[model samples]
Target: METTHSPIRPIPVHPGLPVIGNTLEYLRDPLAFFRRLQRDYGHERMVRINVGGRATTLMLKPEETKQVVQENNRNYGRGKSFAILKTFLGNGLLTSEGDLWRKQRRLAQPAFHRQKLAILAETMIEEAVAWADRLEKVADNKPVNFSTATTDVTLRIVTKTLFGSSLGDQLDSLSTALANLNHFAINAVVNPIRAPKWVPTPSKRNFERATTQVNNLIFGIIESRRKTGETRDDLLDMLLRATDEETGEGMSDEQLRDEMVTLFTAGHETTATSMAWTLYLLAQHPGILQRAKAEIRATLGERSQPSADDLRAMPYSSQVINESLRLYPPGWVMSRLSLGPDRFGDHAIAANEGVLLSPYVLHHDPASWPDPEHFDPERFAPELSKERHPYAYMPFGGGPRLCIGNQFALMEMQALLIVLLHRFELRPVPGLQVTAQPLISLRPRQAVQIYLS
Candidate 1:
């Protein structure tokens, strides 16, 4: 006997204004718009909404989302959405596609291997301990903007780990240039009407100047390393020594710069933002905070620094970090462009269309998470987590292109939390409202003010 299959249907389109479509609604407030879609048509699996004069499909179901990002990822390339990022990153692992991406991924893989990351964890703890000591000296029961504090510490850690050198006098200017460049890139992504690149708009000029500043700094490091032939067992050293298995060739200076900058850009702020959110959430929930503290005390005893083995023993602390990431994933929304036709259950998607998969939306789905808005780390307890879909809680993303530094980020967060929580008690500032700002990463709109006593 032959079996019959259901007919494929066109994806449902959300009603929108002519030409501009849903762009206005999206621009006004992106997360709200996404939540509204989930509330209204979430069962539809896929819904099409026009943004900036183009139709983009939103993948609403976890199963379909998994297929697009993991199983059929080849058909969904980085596409035009990453063009602005490419202007700065220049075909780095984050933005590259096809053979170049494959080659880059291969060359960079060994640096993140388990043994290598074990060595890097020491630097993470050292930096976190240094940061905690500095805070103790100046905190004096006054509110500190932990967002800024975490950013500074994480930048230091990444600088030491990646280049094996301190920024020294160049730190402030380099930080400012990256900040300006980030602001420019994000604005360009959202605004539909952009002046030609040749036009010297103030924003464009700033972006160009920032790009030059960053390029010069990175190239200077590369030149110095080549001339000196020094070895520090840092990421740059590994990259310099890494040879392609296929051709026995190493990355050129330009390639090294791109990867280093990419790592710097993607690595630092995302970890810092997540740490700030974790701190904010802990401040708000004293009981949960105490539980994490108890676990840390039991695991590490009187040790000021947590080794890799000690970090692995703190299960509750890891759960708190996972729960915080679910609430405020730094890489909130991920985009892919279709290289060919595809189907999600009964719905069909055409070639060249843009598809969005939001970890933020998936994480907050009521089907997978009961009382989705509640902050409950117990939801991640092993027994409960085993029953949930794997894709339901992907804070670092999923599949072949999953963030390379995910383990590095988690270990860093765990180490910092252990050191800081051991030394001080965190309290929230009264009458302050913290909101999430969606940028290159999800960050707090204002400083997350907390007092240490």
Candidate 2:
């Protein structure tokens, strides 16, 4: 009963050329290529993929993923996994490692705890309602560019949650700056990691402009707060008051700015992408849509407005969000380098051997999910999820580095979906397919159009 699985031969490699493995193939159509691999080669394969001149094997199996994320977490750190994000996010929590990351994580932890989220839920609801109410005016068959709508809402939510009302008009420059910065980060990923930021390229110049814009805007906020000596009870207030529990020291204004920018990027973009996918899924499946509507109608009872309590009563709404993330995870692709020797199920992985995982692949594994490609929210039903492997459905990722903003995301998504469903029926426009565009988050390549009926 206790015998360890013996090491097996390395799984068959997918064909590739020298100096460049499956990079071109992957770049062409990653999701489709991944599907082709899964059909030809199951989860255990060691298919080599060239990632910007580096030959790294893509590890697709769920147990393989568990080894990297949970059992041997310390031996792995983000490494080059998020180099592309470095251009925009820098070394904030999403990409940093070792002592810096550990210290920052400790400092930022209190602002995202359960009690904090409960308090913030009111603000989340306020922002969701403000956006949803605007949609009530759109006529039937009029297409709504949901991607833009969610982006605006998530940005505003992050702003209000972080700064409260005091910094109201001050956020305009920050939002404009961030909009340009995200594109630069997306462009960086298309090129090699070694390219210097000061390359005189158009994207590089644009990146600097956006980065400078944010830096100037943040310094202004800090100066204003310092001069007035006023502390609003938002994320900014929490950071100001948060003394390091171990050392009793507080973060510098510069430090706070870095963390603020981090939250703004991580806190909003991923959630926007998640919202886009959730709306697309709702548009695709009207049966689930009606069930979701019934829950909202019954709980809220023909009220023109819905409260947080009404959102809580809709179980199927939460399940729909969960299922959407399952099928199309926001943090879809992740990689980590081994710091020391490790053994995964059957492979002996040496130190610095990079491990790759695509949540898109693991979430849709045939062995783990019935008709793996299908979108079924019931898969997240408590009873059903318990029977599945814990690692099989990781959209926010797994283990310690899992996104701290996950609860913030889920709550916002639930509230938004509840309000939208109760207000309008979204139907997909003809001939438009929702295609995944991988960036820091996975988004639909085309604008996910939903006609508000």
Candidate 3:
């Protein structure tokens, strides 16, 4: 009998110029590149990614991804994947590892807890109506970027829900600052980290200016709220009261800034992006849009507004949101650095390795989703009984660090969708293509326009 050795595994790699790795190409089109890797290499395989002189192995296996994200997860953190975000976010819960992140999460939990969320639901409905009214006023025979409208509504809603109704006074500056910061954040992903912060690079300069302005604004808000003797039921109140059970110490101002920045970014931008895509998707598929509108109308009635309770009554609307996330999740790619030498089904993954899990790729997997490109919401239907891997559909992620704002984002989107249906029937503008621009989140490349019918 001949001695048998284990078959050598092939780590997938695409060609790139020296030092740049696949940085330019990957930036040009992330979704396509990732899909190519999946096609050429079998599942549970490795992809040697060259991102500006860095060579990292990205594993795309759902099982391996589950192991990394959930079971064996540690303080592996956002790693270099989000190195640029640190300039804007600092040691926020989204980027911080270990005790710092844990403490921040605890401090911020109450603001998003059940009771406060109930209050927020009412606020969400009010904001939704306000958005619809604004659109109703602008129902001229003109083209509108439905994506922009959706993003604006969600942004204002999240700001209001997190800080209360007085938030609009600060939102204009916050919105501009966020827009500037998002570009810089993306540049930070591609540019060398060692470069001086004051360097003439437009992105770095823009980042510094935006962060300073945003911090001043955020810190001012925190200070004003702290000075108020009256305790209001919002995120600020919860942050003030949160104390570590073991240490009985509250988070300091610096810690608060980190958490606030994290929330400001995660709390709004992701929700805005998701809502934007959802509105565009509903516009693209009229049948689905009609069904969603019918559900929203039946549940909400021709009433003044739809409250939080009304939200629970719209299941198909929720299904549409779920399907949209499945097809175009806001959080497209997240990576975790390995702690030690590890083995995943005989692959000798090394210590300190960077492993990536992409919802964009997994969501579009043909083997997993039938007629994957079709705009079918049935994929997430409550009635469907088909078996799919748990990791195959990770919109908010899994494991210990699963997105705490999962409930908040979903509720916010549901409210926005309901109001959108009442205001107008969106019809797609021709010759415009909307594709996922992969970043910290999978933001849409261009504003998707629609007729405000």
Candidate 4:
């Protein structure tokens, strides 16, 4: 009998220049470059590529990606790319890991529970209704910038729902500061060779100013709440009361500030972008949009606003959101660093190697989703979704570290969609091209213009 040993070949790499490696190419167009890697080299398998001098492995298939994100999850940590986010987000649930992350997640879990989210649904609807009314007044022959409108509404909803009231006097300055910080952070991620903060570059200066403003605003809110010594049953109240089971101590002011900023930023940006893209897609496909509207009409006839119960009844609305997420996930790519030597099928993963899971690639794979480029909400229909792998769709991510605000975000989006579609039929501007620019979130490259009738 002949004994045969399976060859242990190195992971295939996509061609790129030395020194900077794939940094410049990736920055040029992330989605295309990643798609090329899958189309040319992936073979429905993991491939190693150079990213900013780091040997990064891209996991494109569902089973292998499940190994990284869900099965052998503990052996991975957040990647170096996330290090830049810590300056803005701090050690909140999104950035922190290990024991601290566990403690925080446990403490914050109850706040996003179904019952808790129901309490905030009315506020979400009120904000959506108010925004729709405002748009009705201003909308005319001119095309409205849907991106800006959606962001404004989501921001207002987040502020009111989380703080128990609007930002009031601090809204303008805080909004401007957050926008500047987002630009600076995305620029830092794309341009690996960046000057240190002390080097006094314009972007750096603006970032510092914005950081200070955001910190001041959050700290001021915490201080004001502390002075009042009253419980308002919002996120701030929940955070104030969250005590560690072992330590039995509440979060300090600094800790509160970190979590607040994390919630405020992550809370609104991703939800707004997702909703904006859904409307954009609906405009392109009138038949699907009409189906969605008909479902809403049947489920919630003559209701002024959708309650949480109404959201559950309107299944197509959820499908539309799910399909949009499949096409354009806000958190397009998730990065994790390996903790130890490991093997997935034939490939060997070394200690401390960066691993990435791109939901965009997996969702678009022709093998998994037939006619992957086609816009079909029916892919997520309840009966059809039963046969798909659990890991195949993770707009809110998977495993223990899944986003805590998942339920909250879904409810907000569903309510907003119901209110907006009821009031206006969005028509895309003629000859206008809207492209997805992959940043911290996948946002429109420019303003998405739509005529609200």
Candidate 5:
């Protein structure tokens, strides 16, 4: 006898305006839109919604997310969602797909290994100490934008570690250019109807100019290194010296530039955002702040420089950073296009469909975390965390496409927090409100004002 199977059903669609669908609601407020989806249709595991004139399914469960990003990831690709990013990042690890991604990942893997990153910890601590010293000169109790401050310090750290040289006078220009490119990329992602590349709109002009500026800076570094025959043993030197085992071939200057810019942008932006949020949370919770400071002091008494071993010894500090990432993950939402048909429970998905996975949503799920809104670092304690689903708390993402620089970012944050907290006390400024702004990264909607004394 032959057996019959029930046909897969279409995922429920969220009601929205004709044609445009949920774009307005999404653009108006992305986080709220996600929460609304969770409230209204989360039981379905997947919900279809039109975003920017395309139908996409929002993955609502940890298991569903794991399947898309890990178990059956081959059926999904970066697709058109990353077109704007590819415009700037070229085919770097974040945006590349298939064999290219595999090859690049192989080549870049060695540069971010534990041993390689251990050597960079000294540079990270020095930069953090220098930042703390600069802050010491500022008037105590005066308000400072901690968000911008963190960005500046992280940028310096990444520049030194990546290029083996301080940015010096070029810092401001490079920062501005990268900011411009980031702004353009996010806007273009939401507004699908963008002017043609040659149209020369204000945004387009700014983007092109910024792209050129960044290109000049990166290519200049590569050219100078080649001409000087210098080996600083920094990330650049490692990439320069890396060769494919099969072909014994190395990355060309253009390839190096792509990977370098990808690392530079991703390296600084995500770490800075995480640090800013961590500092902000500590300011709001005085007890947590004090406890973290006590841990720092106990771990490194009278020692301003924190070594890799010192970082490992500060578990509470690590927990604080972990909790902050859970609350305000920099890479909040990720997108992929289906390359083949797939299924989630009884719901059917066709090839070419778009899928959205949000770490922010998963991290805050009440099912996985009781009293999810409450700030609690102890939730990440090894004893408690071992019981949770692996995909339930993916701050740096997961699977093969996980952020390559996750370890680097974590150590950078740990070093900065240890040095900065040891040197001064951080107090939130009165009457200042900070909210999450969903950009290329989840940034504070405004300057996170705080006082250092």
Candidate 6:
């Protein structure tokens, strides 16, 4: 592909303070700022803004977003946000680019294959059952913090499926450390300017401590697996046995650590957040909840546990989750950098400029989703979804770089819902209104308190 020599039209500039540009406004409230930009400037209208004195092009239309992520994806690479993430995630599948990413993605793809997912479905149901049992023991008409509960169960499931263990007593500490690391990463992305890692700023020092603890735990898991020559048919086993077809070499210990941490970080939070939001949505919408229960009950009959086949039969359950994701997608924003001067739609994107593809903005766009604020699972009904743009509802993102664990995430969500909804009716804790935090994943800013009656 050749870069056209034709002079490119200037993208409309969003006026900002000299030097700092849009950094402060964006840092204060990114979703609000982006939504304002989208409303003021119409869809497909490109605008130039600055982050840490760097020029970034904010794209609004799904078509332009498609070009950046799918059609001309090669011309764009994971941008600044991911660069900040590399400090923690290292050169794993999430942070690596080019051939390294290609090779890593290929080697890991088989582990998430359908057969593996089908096998994992039973484990998800088992975890959900255990979680419900714990909930039942404590349900005394008091408001339960659903957010904490879902995160706890999801983390357990990920540890069992990926590491082949529950991570023993370190589970609590590891969760805390990962949360600290994620907070630091999000702050770094928004604040832009920061002291170097060695400078010993309070945040930097804390980040270093968190990284050290997480790395030790992950490396310990790798060592234990290697020493035992474990073969549980889990992700760790798949990775340990994986050999590059061309190089005919297995992953190094460091490489294995990187991938494990990547999966731990990637797999756990997003899906957990998705489930938390789904519960909140169902609680808020009783009609939708009842309809979903009807499908679940009708599909499962007398069985308390849902099999892989039972999950497949509950399409409404999936639709309810889908609709919740549209309203509060965990992975709300996707970023890219133009590798060279490129054309997306009719606009010329200059080399090295940053591009943002915000699912929050696109998902809520009135043109694409009518009464976008409403909780309507029917929108996802097969016949209705066909009318929308392929990229219009991107919860897990799109293109070759789309989330590899998409099916795994969905299956896990379905299993949890089947077991949870069967046992409990989640009602809102009086007067509390759940709000989106819009961090690394769109988490509930407040504790989502629900009465499990």
RMSD of each: 1.5, 2.5, 3.2, 2.5, 1.8, 2.1
Q: List where candidate 3 sits over 4 angstroms from the true fold.
A: 1-21, 191-194, 197-202, 383-386
TM-score of 4: 0.96
Off by over 4 Å in 1: 1-5
After the best TM-score superposition of candidate 1, give how far the Cα of residue 297 lies from its true spot, in angstroms: 0.8
lDDT per residue for candidate 2 within 301-345, as digits (tens), equals: 858767766667778889999999988898778878879987655
Name model 2 segments beyond 4 Å from true. 1-8, 43-46, 166-170, 193-198
User: How close to the true structure is residue 433 of candidate 1, measured as C-alpha lDDT?
Assistant: 78
Candidate 3 achieves a global lDDT of 0.77
lDDT of 6 by residue, 1-453 (tens): 985565566788888999999888988888888888888775546677786788888888788878888989899999878988999889998889999888888788888999888888888888999999999998887988878888888999998898777878899889888889988998987666677766878888888899999999988888988998868857889998988887887888888888988888878888888898998888888999989988888887898888887888888999998998999988888789889988754568778888988889888888899998899999999999999998888998898888888898999998899898999887877788988888888989999888998
lDDT of 1 by residue, 1-453 (tens): 995557988788999998889999998988899989988888897789998888899988789989998999999998565899888888789999988888988999999998998889899998999999999988996899998999999999898899887879777777788888888878888777899888999998888899999999989989999999999879999999899999898999989998998899877889999999999999999999999999988877877778878888899999999999999999888889999998777788889889999999999889898898788999999999999999998888898989889998998899899899998999999987789988768899999989998
Per-residue lDDT for 1-453 in model 3, tens only? 995546555555767898787887777777888888777664555677887676777666677778878777873556675666776778877778877777777767767777778788887888788888888778678767766777777777767765765575678888788779877777666555556655687666777788888889888878887788557656666777788776889878777877776776787788888888888888889999999988877876768568888888888988898899998988888877877766666565677777778887778778778777777887876656247888888899887778888898899989888887876788887777798777778888898777887
Winning model by TM-score = 1
Displacement of the residue 361 alpha carbon in candidate 4, Å: 1.0
**Each prediction's whole-model lDDT (CA):** 0.89, 0.79, 0.77, 0.86, 0.89, 0.86
lDDT of 2: 0.79
Task: Name the 10 consecutive residues with the lowest summed lDDT in model 2.
Answer: 189-198
Clash number by candidate, in order: 0, 0, 0, 0, 0, 0
- Deviation in Å, model 4, residue 252 alpha carbon: 2.0
Least well predicted 10-residue stretch by lDDT in candidate 4: 3-12
Please, what's the RMSD in Å of model 6?
2.1
Model 3 collision count: 0
Model 6: worst 10 consecutive residues (lDDT sum): 3-12
